[model samples]
Target: MLIDLHKATLLVIDVQDKLVPAMADPQGILARIRWLLQVATELGLPTVISEQYPKGLGATATALTDAAPQAIVVEKLQFSCVAAECLPESLLAHEQVVVCGMETHVCVLQTVLELLALGKEVFVVEDAVASRTPASREAGLRRMRDAGAQVVNREMVVFECLRGASHPRFRHISKTFLVGEQP
Candidate 1:
């Protein structure tokens, strides 16, 4: 089944102020992730954001921080979101999860695997997740795919959420993500 927007969430993991500028492709990753968040919001989907040790790593980026002011920010030390007591409460298991954000080999990969093991389907937006090195990012994606998680592009997710162009929120969500063509 495709990702139903009514039962989907956009999970932003560790896209923090300090961590972002250090990424190999900061602007590109952030742009795609922000697009994901915007489209999710436009479609009335829920969002869960995580901060990997905020006291040390700092807060989420200003743009993301403002994207959904109502979104809960989980300050976590664990690599997986379910491992964080307060965080899992937000996931709710209501539907599929579309994951993105930093440190592909660390928190993002770990969280995706854990979610999949829980029998929850996860879609990782490839270009939005990054690592300190290209090799690390590639390795992380390979491992996640092997674990049964679907690593797809941001546009694939946008269409799955849209389902059909006739949907009421189609144009709004589509334009927000800059989703060009359907697959």
Candidate 2:
């Protein structure tokens, strides 16, 4: 099923400073997540950013926080955001969630599984998430997909959110954000 922008919230999980450096293609993942955050902000999607034990892992990267100043920041001790119960009511109310962030096999995977269990539609952005190794990254994606989450790319979410060229921001979004983006 296609993502419904109005019904969806953007969930950025554990893209913290210390944690980011340990992931594979750290810069690339950060760039994609940052790009998605910018698009989500422009499109007016409610965004939630989770920082897992920030004191130890460090806060959400400045680049991301700067990208979407309006994002609701949540601090969680649990691997799964749902288990931590720190998410704001506004974010939990959404029917769908577009997710990105670090450590695909751990935090990202646990959160996606729990979100799926809650019966919410979960879309995991592949290129926007990573692990220290390609094997673990692919494993996380496989597990999430097997558990009923739709694995997608950043542009898929963008197009689905915009729906089509008829969208008022289509021209601007395409030109500004999606210039050389590939599927």
Candidate 3:
């Protein structure tokens, strides 16, 4: 199913500061994620960010927080964010979720599966998720797909969300968040 921003939210999973630098190509991942937040904001979609054990791992990366100032930052001991207080309730009205973040195998994968089971249309940005080890990251992507989450490329999601140039914020979103186009 196509994700409608009016019916969607962006759930960034565990892109904590302390943990992020260790992931491969961390900056590239967060930059794309930050762009997603900008586009989501222009579309007026809400955002939720979760940090797994923030005390130990540190809060979310500074750039992400800056990009999504109004976004809710959830601190959770549970690997899956559906267990976090207020988050599930806040997301109750949202039927579709666009997810991106770190440690793909452990937290990101588990969260995607749980969210899917809860009946949300989960769209995971493949390029924006990672694990310290490439093997686990690859495994997580496969597992999330196996559990029925839609594995989508970044440009596909952006264009789908934009729908057309007639969209009111089209030029602004394109100018601010659009990265280099691929072939």
Candidate 4:
């Protein structure tokens, strides 16, 4: 199913300052997530940032916060945002969720599972998530897909949201964000 911008919320899970340096392709993943956040903002989509125990992991990356300054930030101890019960009502009010973050095998995977269980349509942005090792990242992506979450890339999410070139933001988005991207 296409990701309906009106019904979807972007959930950035634990892309914290301390945790990011330990992930594989940390900079690349952050770039993708940052791009997604910027596009989400331009499209006027709601976004939620989840930090796992900020005292330890630190807060969401500075770049991400700057990209979507209006995003709601939630702090949690549980790997799964649902289990932590820390998700704000604003996030829960959405029917579909587009997710990206660090440590794909742990927090990202767990959150995807629980969100799926809750009957929410979950989309895991593969290129926007990673673990310290490539193996773990692959495992996490496989598990998430096996569990029924749609596995997609950042560009896919953006295009799905735009739906078509006729969309008012399409040309601007293409020139601003999709210029160098490959289908």
Models 1 onward score TM values of 0.91, 0.97, 0.92, 0.96
- Per residue, candidate 3 scores C-alpha lDDT tens digits across 1-183 of 887767888888999889988988877778878777766777777889998888999999998899898898888998888765437566756898888898889888888888888899999989878789899999999999988999997666777777889988888777766745631
Clashing pairs in 1: none
Judged by TM-score relative to the true structure, which candidate is superior, 3 or 4?
4
TM-score of 1: 0.91
Which of 2 and 4 is ahead in lDDT?
Answer: 2
lDDT of each residue in 1-183, candidate 1, tens digit only: 678787777889999989988888888777777766776777777888999888988999978877777677888888777777546555766668888988998999988888887788888889789888899999999999999888998778878877888989887665644646421
Tell me the RMSD of model 3 versus the true structure: 2.0
In model 4, residue pairs whose N, Cα or C atoms come closer than 3 Å (at least 3 residues apart or on different chains), thus clashing, are: none
Off by over 4 Å in 3: 85-88, 179-183
Full-model lDDT for every candidate: 0.81, 0.92, 0.83, 0.92
Q: Choose the strongest candidate by lDDT.
A: 2
RMSD of each: 2.6, 1.3, 2.0, 1.5
* Better structure of 1 and 3 per TM-score: 3
User: Predictions ranked by TM-score, top down?
Assistant: 2, 4, 3, 1
- Which scores higher on lDDT, 2 or 3? 2
Which candidate should be chosen as best, given TM-score against the real structure?
Answer: 2
Worst 10 residues of 3 by lDDT: 174-183
**Clashes within 3 Å, all models in order:** 0, 0, 0, 0
- Candidate 4 regions off by >4 Å? 181-183
Assess candidate 4 and give its TM-score to the true structure.
Answer: 0.96
After superposing all C-alphas onto the true structure, candidate 2 shows an RMSD in angstroms of 1.3
lDDT of 2 at 114: 92
